[model samples]
Target chain A: MGGEYLANLADSLVTVMDKMAGLTCEWSEKAPQLPAITEGVTVVSLLGFTGAEKGRVVMEMDIETAQKIGEALNQEELGPFDKMIFYALSELSNIFCGAAITQINNGPRRPGLRLTPPNILVGEGLEIFGERAHLETASVFWEGGLIYIHLSLEGGAAL
Target chain B: MIREHLQVFAKASSDVFASLGVQAVHQAPLAPPDSFFSRYDLAIIVGLARDLRGSVVYSMDTETALALAGQMMGGMSLPGLDEMVKSAVCELGNMCAGSSVCNLPGLTADITPPTLITGSKLAIMAGSDNVLMTEIATSFGTVEVRLGLEE
Candidate 1:
């Protein structure tokens, strides 16, 4: 149940990212190709959930690729998110956690819930901690297309 | 008031990570509004529920963490988990939380335990946030972190 929920969360997130950033966003059952380099641009953002359950939500992306997303914020569609990786990454996390926290706070079924701003991770040659689950997934694109991925950590904690 | 303070601490987190050449996205990026459990590895997070109403978490993964510790030690190769990484990751959380205490609007917060998660087994308790975790596509695999509130 928890794992399924995590996957669903990832899907919902894809929706939000697509609507806000307009990346032609989609998920993929096929694995995402991990290039030798992280495409010279990756935006990562996360939020903290405290009380009872603890961990964080982190989002990563390629900068050059991000720039290609043209989501109109105020009647202005920006170019590739490559240059604004940091800004795009942080703001995106904020949005994700903001909604998550709100739901947690309001859900009677949920236990204690709280959230913090996303703490972004930036660098080159970052190593993977564990086996990549959901490495390949069925993704629904805003364009009603489909995509795949190498993996997506969605929400997880080390045991 | 608490919101503003949270912002300050959020910036502090970014600053610390930036020093290590990482990014810390705050309330803007959307950390997955519909997911449960904000994810972080080897992190120390605290809440300012009383005077101020917000929380903060400091994070780093295995590789980047070791690298940061190595840099602190003046270019020493981090073969594996060592005291350097432990202290660095912990202190990062401490600094961010503490800085918020002084920098934020109205409140003081105490520290909390720093939980370290390792291996492939990750536990994500059911959760959904206003914003989803920010996805970072990098040369390596994707790495993400998030902080959320329940107000």
Candidate 2:
């Protein structure tokens, strides 16, 4: 993946947040330090892209943050973290990824990527590990809290 | 048809493990009651797109994971679920998913890179009403394959 591609993704995210949730999100210049053992549960949304270049995009956030942003997107007051919030998060991931991948395809080196439906995982002290090609991480700050976006390409070139 | 597709995936997983010299016996699909949420200590998730659109999640406990990783690393015993072990397990998931697409005959599909998730309590939502699940038994332990695909 190119730096240009990363820029497009970040821009897509910021734009999506503004349009969908009416929230302003900015990418953190410095990588935020996460404690070794986080106190609350984390909700992660995993999605995949395929076509010319295969890749994966993951969105990570605390459950509370997910709840807050999910509520914003739904334009309703949701009590605690529940199934409704999970559905909202899943839809949020789908919309954000669809927009970002669309931008990449329209731009140079368009991969013509297609997306797989997102899966949401909820757990305490969750950690994700795997081999990645050209993995890039961006931490975004919003009114709710900090969320992380991890984008990585896969295949021969990535090696 | 979805059940058949899931069966293809199960056979693909067993075949991949067999190639790695592990005897994995795949059981029949679990009867369902609409959507199901399952939890495990470790899970490898890969998204499928194109002809096959949805996700396949392979979940197991840490002990089963360590044993399988050890087998992948030339049958050496692993002390714990270290980075190498986790990477090996992730690769195994990737291989299983790739093989599944191949076993589906003429379907043109693609699999995303495997994502290994570890947590004290990991809960997975199939996200599909028509969920197909099966358990595969091996000397190492049991690995559950839960597939949720778009109709």
Candidate 3:
């Protein structure tokens, strides 16, 4: 995995979070590991990219943090995790993924990648698995809470 | 368009299962759409892009998943959802989605690697509420394939 690619993705995530949700978040230097949330609800949103190269971006966070971010984006108090909140988070995931892929497309690789609509999964004690691919995991944190991003670039057109 | 896509997907699934030496019969979608919460314990979601873009989710119980994966692995008796089992299941999803998109005459699309999710009380929203779901009864069990393509 190229550092420049990772940097572009991380920068896009930070910029999008700050600009879209008015939330200041940064990619942590700590080793990327999916957090263990044995209890409580976890919200995971995934988007895939296709073109010269293929990959995916997964954004995951606890429901409380998701609701808080939703409130921030909607600029109003949300009443108990409803459909609006789910849409807000799903759109946020789309924005984050779009930003990251845009940066990559404009970068040196120029992998004219197109995005698929985001899929939002809400559940408790959920375990996600995507093996046999090059994976790069990172964590993004904000004042509200933290979320994990997993990027997997599978076999496709050379990067 | 939705019905056409569903038919293509069903045919592709039947072909894939036939190639695997398994008998899979496509049936009408499971009725009373339960919205998002899935009744099955395992789901392999594959995102499609280009001409037909959205998601194709293969949902089934653990036993069905194990049986399908086992068939893919040359009829091996799988125990649980181990790493190998999970990989095989994802590949099965990849095959089904890939085949379906390719068979969509006059449309060219690509599929992202499958994302496998397993747990209790699972609810999934893929792109929109307009999802076409159907069941394929195999010798192993019933597998539901959900096509949530963006209009």
Candidate 4:
């Protein structure tokens, strides 16, 4: 995938976040750095795409950031690492990826992409990898916190 | 029927471990849902659809995850859970779920890609409340496999 496609996907994600979670997010020029373990709990949600295109979308942020967003969506204060928070995060990824796929399919060269349900991962220290893939990452600032969104496409083909 | 399906997962876990050059002994009867503790630090969840609609979760601690990753990488010493190690762990869960589904007679199912989660006091809430869990004793450590099928 090209940078333009990634930018479009990031834009779609931001729009979804704002609309669904009521959290405002802006794209950052800086890239995401490796998260330090001292930063507390981190949640990484992965949603894979198959069918016309093969790729995966990853959304990573700290637990505090997730809780804030989840609270906004749920309209209540959520406990730390609550199952409701995880479900909210997973649905956020799912909706974001689904919208991004629609944007991709609208392009001239449609990959006919279809998104899989979001898979939620929560941990203190984590590293994610995709085999035979090309990765495009975008850092976004939301509610005084930084979150990273990564789009990894398999086989290095342009979609 | 549920016991029969659970047995398929047990067999697949043993076979996958054996193929990775590790010995995993079955603990016989499956564990109850409440018996599953939240002490595990890492978990890999795979969703099942079609003939079987639910999911399978493989839970373990950091030690077990690293050990299993090392075994999968041919005894490579892992400093921590890096990208490579995480991928390996996810692939292991994917293989276990995929192979188990194949063993079921007259049953067809499609599995979602495996997802890995690591944290303290973590819990997996599957679609169904009725879960059948089994413990597998491996050379490195113990892995608890939970199966949740919708009625």
* Best candidate (score: TM-score): 3
Ranking by DockQ: 3, 2, 4, 1
Clash counts for all predictions: 103, 0, 0, 1
Q: On residues A1-159, what C-alpha lDDT tens digit does candidate 1 reach at each position?
A: 234434544565676666785655655444343321243333334344455554444444544433433233323456643334445545665675566556655666564555554444333332222121222233334443222222223233421
- Count of backbone collisions within predicted model 3: 0
Clashing pairs in 3: none
Fill in the DockQ of model 3. 0.82
Top candidate on lDDT is: 3
TM-score list, all predictions: 0.46, 0.91, 0.92, 0.74
lDDT per model, in order?
0.44, 0.80, 0.81, 0.74
- Candidate 2, B127-150: lDDT as tens digits: 454567888888788998988887
* Reference A-B contact fraction recovered by candidate 4: 0.08
- Candidate 3 chain A: worst-modelled 10 consecutive residues by lDDT: A29-38
> Ranking by TM-score, best first?
3, 2, 4, 1
Better of 1 and 4 by TM-score: 4
Model 4 Cα lDDT, one tens digit per residue, B1-151: 6677888988888899989988999875785677334568788877676677667888888888898899888898888987888888888998888899999889987666666766674545553556788888899888888887767
lDDT, candidate 2, equals: 0.80
Give the runs in model 1 whose Cα sits over 4 Å from its true position. Answer: A18-39, A70-88, A127-159, B1-151
Model 3 chain B — which ten-residue stretch has the worst lDDT?
Answer: B27-36
How many angstroms is the interface RMSD of candidate 4? 4.0
User: Cα lDDT of model 1 overall?
Assistant: 0.44
